[model samples]
Target: MHQSFISYKNFKSLKGSVVLCAAVLGLYVVAEPSATSAGGTWLGYVGGCLGGVLMVWLACLGIRKRKYKNTELLAVGWVSTHIYLGTALLLVVSLHSGFHLGLNIHSLAYAFTVMVILTGFYGLYAYSIYPDKITLNRDGMSRDSMFAEITEIDEKSLALSEKISPEMFAKISENVEETKIKTSLLTRLFSDRSLKEGAIYKAIDFVREQHSGSELIKELDSLLQEKESLVGKIERDIRYHFRLGWWLYLHVPLTVGALLSLLIHVYVVLFYW
Candidate 1:
């Protein structure tokens, strides 16, 4: 129930951002660079240097995860600082550019930085929300446990189906097929909602009409309902698991692109200046 991202870690980072913004503004006010905070000016260089340093440090988060690959830097503080400082980096870089971007590689770097920051925001939002959903959906049953439950349901449903007519056996087979074992991520998440809904309703109607009549139908209906429930649980588990992970697909790639562009930005500014 408690999400760490919104707590003391981010609060400290927010405090740091406030102080940093004040410093950037105070320097700009006092020094008063010509025409703008041009990169050549002392204040301008300060901004660019600060922004560049922040970007490089931000890149360290990736290294920390890969290299450390453990709880060493995996604290809430590291991640929250990374997120908050990343937001601050955008502002610092904008100041560094003196709000003057154009059709140059420098501007391309700016665009990439913006993309990275935007994706970070998305990742933050995703992390804040999705973990809770995944945990709740899991409800203490791990994915392997869910699979095991499904396997047991399969055996029971098949045994029960053998006592029924061919028509009912085919119905059970079709219902089992709806579980959909090998689906792409998007298809697993969104493709079969209506289909599952329709199937649940039809199964409910089947149980109501037939379960009270024939003993065979009654037993088959119980097995059918159990299988349907297991399938629903499995699908939810799949959907939420994907939700927790899919943000990284976009966030990490954009981050690497931003870092590459950032390197180019540094090299060009240093040599060209």
Candidate 2:
């Protein structure tokens, strides 16, 4: 029974978040201030202040993570707090604003906060699932080893294709040149189409359709099949790696936006309200 950050310390962070939200909710009810969208009442100010502190602390997680040697702040515990407190911030802020989302800076801050939290949840899920998938996909083979084997197969396939016929040699050679094992990031992220376009696939198709069941043809076919399988594995590995990290591109910018908006929000609330 391995416990993850979500269940770290027997769900201590979660319990803390629950207690925090409950306390805020109880205060909001007991105070029974005039239902207003802005943070004008005593309870609203308390919720706003608490939410602000939580948001700032959560944003500091990046710094804490980078300080790997800082044992006083365990990364796992910080991450656990970041997750649970982040979720609680939503409730705290909602109560602070009295659930009145309007088209203003206040609402903009709220919107950005919500987006950041949503992206954080996506990141949590991605981390939970993709690491195991990546490990399983790699198995015992390194990417470099798999790639070297593919190149070896290509060379062997080319040699066998030459022995068969000039047409076979030309097709295999052309396919090899066109086969891009190291491709663009966009190609890796979006399409595994390169796997289908390799020399091995072309050779296999050519052998099946144009040649008889000679021993040479059979050998070439075997080599091509092996190469194709190896190429498939490489494509999958690339895909898994990309999927595991791609969300950060969105998550990071959203988090920055949220933080900036929150600062402006605090300033405006303090000075204007």
Candidate 3:
């Protein structure tokens, strides 16, 4: 199985960012502020510039992903750095705001900036987890191959059921049908296998044990069980996709909000201050 991204390498970025934040904090502590102790001061303005630069760099991660792959560009290393630096940007931006907010465009801009960072942290978490799970569960086979196996198993099971007694055929037919069909969204989202796979397995097991002497029943039971396993993993991979991809749905909009807030902040500050 492939490993998760929660290794020492990813955390190394956190260590570096922590050190940088600590040094910045030390400087901020020593630098005496004006009477207001706001972003109008020297350190506060420096923090503002640093935060703005980090925000732009964080956005460039998208470009990094698109432009650099399959080369010696260290894409994985870049992503880890992106996450950690984005984390540190939170502290920097908060320092820039100087624990002071007014009921104006400045506060609104700060709110959206925080929103962008929060969503990014969530995306970071998803990246660290979902990919490994999906990779391990998929084994070596593609989803299409797994599905083709299921389809072939279903056809064989149906044809075999016809040779049995009518009463047995009717009961086994339901099991085959339930095991072969495509899963529902509710099933994919949550563990709804109990009602579907569980019910069919229960009935099939009872029938298989009652007529244990038949070779076809034994083979059919084993085949159906295999199909059940394959389908379960396919659904699990689908869930992992949902978990990973859903973060972008929130992150993209928040990024746009942050950029708009930035533009407004720039125009207002330039015009007034």
Candidate 4:
């Protein structure tokens, strides 16, 4: 025989919540009847409030369930409910506002909420895409190995500098110091235009005039090899950084905008309404 058990707490929590939400929505619809409501019709307000409450409740449920057990299941449930209800909220809130947006705090709050939802959608897309990119990159490379590769190139570059003109050697040294050729994604992509390409072109032109076996030619050749490797690493790093960074750019600003709008909305509803 199989024994089965269930948590009364979870059942109680769910049941109490549904009752409370229904009651609140019912009250909003039936109590204190408005003769000429500007915001929305009583039915529209009821529907919107009910939908918002349900969505918020589902999100909270997702959080609470994850804390107990079956995190993956909870996460999936949470994301699904979040996306579906967030989309619903867009419609609900729009109807709740009755499509009348004036220069007021409530309108501002509504606008902010829309902005936050849009950014959040973009963030979801980013989260889904970036992990694949990170996995692809880490398939054969580790962070320490990438650093080691750069160090190897640097050593080669230093050796090559030995046969170059003193001025060229000094310039190379200055460039290296100014740009600490790390495997950082941001530094790799944005800083690539500054030094390596120009240096390689100049070095190639200068070295070609010298005999193949000469010290100047050998130094330049070694420098060219190292530069090519560094460029490749930097390119990959930039791609990785960009893959993750763009979402943050969208999500963070919108969140801040939402909070500001919420504050304005609360102030208007409390004092003006």
Judging by lDDT against the true structure, name the best candidate: 2
The runs of at least 3 residues in candidate 1 whose Cα sits more than 4 Å from the true structure, single-residue gaps closed, are 1-3, 67-74, 181-216
Put down candidate 1 lDDT per residue, 37-126, tens digits, no spaces: 766677877888898788878877877766554775455667777888888887787777887879988888888888888878877886
What ranges in model 2 sit over 4 Å off? 1-3, 34-38, 181-195, 198-200
Query: Highest TM-score, which number?
Result: 2
| Model 3 TM-score, all chains together | 0.81
Expressed as tens digits, the lDDT of each residue in 1-273 for candidate 4 is 311111222344335444554554455455664653334556555654554464345335434655766665444445554545555556556656656788877777677667656766765665666556666755567656766775675566656665566765665565445444435555643443432555555555555655557765676667666665655555565566675566557555655665566555546655776
Alpha carbon deviation, residue 204, candidate 4 (Å): 4.6
Q: Per-candidate RMSD vs. true structure?
A: 3.3, 3.1, 3.7, 8.9
Q: Which is the winner by lDDT between candidate 1 and candidate 2?
A: 2
- Tens digits of per-residue lDDT for model 3 on 109-219? 788778877887777777777777888989988888888887887777777766766766676667665554346666655543532466457646766666657887877
Give one clash count per candidate, in the order shown. 0, 0, 0, 0
TM-score per candidate, in order?
0.84, 0.86, 0.81, 0.59
Sliding window of 10 residues with minimal summed lDDT for model 1: 192-201
Point out the higher-scoring one by TM-score: 1 or 2: 2
Check candidate 2 and list the clashing pairs: none
Superposed by TM-score, candidate 4 places the C-alpha of residue 200 at a distance from the truth, in angstroms, of 4.3
Candidate with better TM-score, 3 vs 4: 3
Cα deviation of 24, candidate 2, in Å: 2.1
